[model samples]
Target: MKQLFDSVRVGRHALRNRLVMAPMTRSRAQFDGTPGDLAATYYAQRASVGLIVTEGTQPCADGQGYLTTPGIYTDAHVAGWKRVVDAVHAKGGRLFIQLMHAGRMSHPDNTPHHRAGVAPSAIAPGSGMFTAKGMQDIPVPRALSTEEVRATVADFAHAARRAIEAGADGVEIHGANAYLVQQFLAPSANVRTDEYGGSIENRARFAIEVATAIAKEIGADRTAIRLSPGMALWGIDEGEQGPALYRYLVTALDKLGLAYLHIAHQGDEALLADIRARWTGTLMVNRAGRAREQVGADVASGVADLESYGAMVLANPDFVERIKTDAPMNEPRREGFFGGTAQFYTDYPTLG
Candidate 1:
């Protein structure tokens, strides 16, 4: 069995282990989309992990979906993230900022400029989002014109550059969940008849362009992307063609020579196998709710180069150490999962 403690390399960084810290939204940033003050401490405390993929950070103003979620577009945003990158690097960790654009999964009130959400089509996600006041129904977003779509792609590239400037080892384009990139990938969320919609190639164009642009801005070695093959969250349906779409998309992305393809597997072993076969680059798998005993099963099975964990890493700062020693882990406080202080963020006890 390939142990989780084994060291690995992804892109340009040499990781200490095969355990990755998956990106997760904590909603603890400043109201202006700057990462919270404790962000440095929070990430640094978990630096023992092989790789840290930070929360979904917006690439542009219209990308803001949740309250206090960070962004990398502004000067302040870059400066704020520098502290986080410095802190993580100081502890001998590699960090990747996950660049996210929320698309139709957003509310005007949640954004810094209160701008309307944008998507490939003007559709509502049929979901409610948490705002400053309370949970509010998501509104129909304006469909991005071909020009706007190009601009959005540029925005991702710019954000990736900013993340690099902030001292991050790399950036992970958030092509998963029900975000903008996935909005384009899912037929239900995309009803456009333009070049960016309709056929599978057209639907996959936006994500490819975003990734290409980021790779060009930085190096292909420092560019990575996260994808969820058939996530139905927020009313997104990739259709029965979902599996095929991913096969085509992954093949195209694989040729780009990206750092790694992080797949948030949603229980489709066949599809996962297909993606693994199609992709030649490094592969990282995030299987939510996997038991403690099965932590490194994917790596051991040769299906994944790295295995990512969220709640376990969130609740246990010394998660890698705990796994090595078979030590008891602190339970994650569900109530303090979002918009909280150090109580649950940086205060997670490490095995001492």
Candidate 2:
């Protein structure tokens, strides 16, 4: 059985252990999308993990959904991230910048130029997003032309190049949650008859193209993606065909020979098993709200090559150490989680 502490190879890097710091949204970046000044210190503090997947960063300006999320498409964004990459590497850690496009999950008030959100279709998520004006209902987004769809894929590719320029080990395409990529996958969110919509193949095309473009710009070994099958969020309903869509998507993604497939499992054992069987690359699994006792269960069972942690790792800087010693952990401060100062960001205690 593989242990959680076992060393493994992911992409071109040989990781020290199988514990990955999952990508999370901290909402602490500058309003213009540069990473917060404390970003370096905060990430370097948790460098003990096998890999540190940075927060969901936008590939372009239009990709920003929530307030103060980072973007990688600009020189300012790249410069800001260089400090973060240097800090993590100084601590002997590997980092991947997760490129996320919010699509219709956005509000005009939260983005630059106050432009409308763009997606595969003009449909609204039927949800509200927190802006400077407080929570506002998300408006229907502008539908991208087929040409614009291709341009969006280029945006992801451009961001991947910029991530490497900022000294990141690689980039992970955020194809999960109810974000742009997931919006395309969700029938409720995507209703176009273009090549990017209609059938399972069409809907999966956008994600596959984005991944392929990134892999081409950067090496396939340095490219990765995260997916959450059957995630019902922000009025997203994959319908009964959701399971089939994932099976087709995973099988197709496997051929690219990218670094790894990270799955944010949504409680379908049968689908999870099917995904595991179909994907032959390094697989990282994140079980949200996973308990302490079940920490290494997936690794021990050979179900996942790596296990990712979010809140526990966020609250405990010495998460790997505490796991090794079976020590008590600190509770995550909910108040300081987003758009905050150092209180809950970099002040988490470590075992002496």
Candidate 3:
């Protein structure tokens, strides 16, 4: 059995352990899309983890879906993240920046340009997004032209390059949740008749292209992607063939030689098993609400090479130390999970 504290190799980096710090959206970036100053301290505080996947970051200006979320597209954005990268590296941590585009799950007020959102089709996600004013209904997004789709693919590649320039160990394409990539994956959200939609291959095309482009920009050994098979959040429904779609998608992506496949498991044990069987590389599994006692269960069973934790790592700065010593963890406060000062963000005390 692989213990949670055991050292592991993920892609081109040698991780200290098999515990990964999962990506979470913390609305702490500057209005200009730069990361908060304390972002470095916040991430460095949790550097004891084997791998640290930074918060969801927009790849372009229009990719913004929530106010104060970080971006990696601008020179200022790169400078801001460089500090975070240096901080984590000083603490001997490996970090991966998660590149995300919110798609139709966005509000005009949330973006600086106040432009209409873009997706495979001009469909509304039928959900609300957090804006400066408040939670606002998502508007109908404009359909991306085939050329624009190609351009957006380039944007992801550029972002990956920028992340590496900023000193990040790697980049993780956010193909999960209700983000842009998954928006294209979901049938209900992507009703286009173009080569990027309709059939399973079409729906999966955008994701595959984004991953391929990133891997090309940065080495495949430093490129990874996080996926949520059958995720239906914010009006995203992959339909009845969701399982088959993932099986096909995972198989295709696996051949790309990506560093790792981080799956935010949505409770399909059978499908997860199938994915484990198809993927020959490193697998990072994030089982929602996974208990402390089950931390290394997947790794022990050979189902996953690593396990990712969001809230647990957020509340426990000494998460790796605590797990190794069997110490009690501080409960994460929900109210402080989003935007806030160091009060809850980096003030979580570690065992002294």
Candidate 4:
């Protein structure tokens, strides 16, 4: 199992270890959607991890669904992210920017222009989102026209280019959680009878297109995607077709030869193994809320090429060291998980 800590090739990059810092939403960017100064320091501090995936950053203004989330569309956003990438690189860390587009999970109050949200269909998600006025029921989002859908995919391609220009090692398309891409994949949220809905192939089309566009813009070697199969979070229900939908989606994406496929492990060991059998490239698995003792099991068992950690990495900047030496980890502060200063973001102590 010690081999799990050894270096391995993932896509075009050779990581020094199999530990990865998972993308986490800290809500610490500027109100203008630019990454703040502390963001660089925060990421740089955790450079010990083999790879660091930055918090979910919107690809465009309308793509933002939460307050203070970063964007990659503007020159300013690129410049801000450049600082972060430079810092991480300086510390000998490889970084990937997770390009996320929040769909109907948005409130106009959270965005700068206060624009209404957009999704595959005009659905409200039947949930509440955090806004300046506190949590409010999400409004029914505007359904993107077929042309707009293509435009959105182009936006992802543009963001991937911008992320490369900003010095990131790669870009991870956020197709997980209850975000824009997942909304389209979930039957409960997407009721469109158009070409983008109805069948598993149709529902998976948007994600496939976005991934293909980004992979084309950058090489497939510099593109990655994250998926959460069987996820039922925030009113997202992919229904009985969830498993089959993911199987088709994974198989289709496998043909693209993306940098890696990051999966948020959702039980079902056999299904996870099935996905691994189908996908031929690097795989990174994140077992959400997993115990510290179980950290490297996925990599050790060959279920994944790398293992990703969220809160543990958040509270323990020296997570790699902690794992190696079996050191105690600082408990993550729930209050500072979202909007906060450097206290929970970067002030965690490393073992002396």
Show the colliding residue pairs in model 4.
none
- Any idea how many clashes model 2 has? 0
Per-residue lDDT for 210-265 in model 2, tens only? 99999999999999999999999998999999999999999999999999999999
- Model 3, 197-222: lDDT tens digits are 88999999999999999998999999
Q: lDDT by residue for model 1 over 1-352, one digit each (tens)?
A: 7767888878888899999999999999998888999999999999999999999999999889988899999999999999999999999999999999998889999987787799999989999998878988998899999999999999999999999999999999999999999999999999899999999999999999999999999999999999999899998999999999999999999999999999999999999999999999899999989999998899999999999999999999999989988999999999889997889888988887
TM-score of each candidate structure, all chains considered together: 0.99, 0.99, 0.99, 0.98
- Strongest candidate by lDDT: 2
lDDT of each: 0.94, 0.95, 0.93, 0.92
After superposition, the stretches of candidate 2 with alpha carbons farther than 4 Å from their true spots are none
- Each prediction's total of clashing residue pairs, residues at least 3 apart in sequence or on different chains, is 0, 0, 0, 0
In model 3, what is the error at residue 228, expressed in angstroms?
A: 0.4
How does model 2 fare in lDDT? 0.95
- List candidate 4 segments past 4 Å from native: none
Which model, 3 or 4, shows the larger lDDT?
3
What is residue 296's positional error in candidate 3, in angstroms? 0.8
Flag clash pairs in model 3.
none
Candidate 4 structure quality by residue, lDDT tens digits, 81-170: 999999999999999999999988889999888988999988788888888898899898999998899999999999999999999999
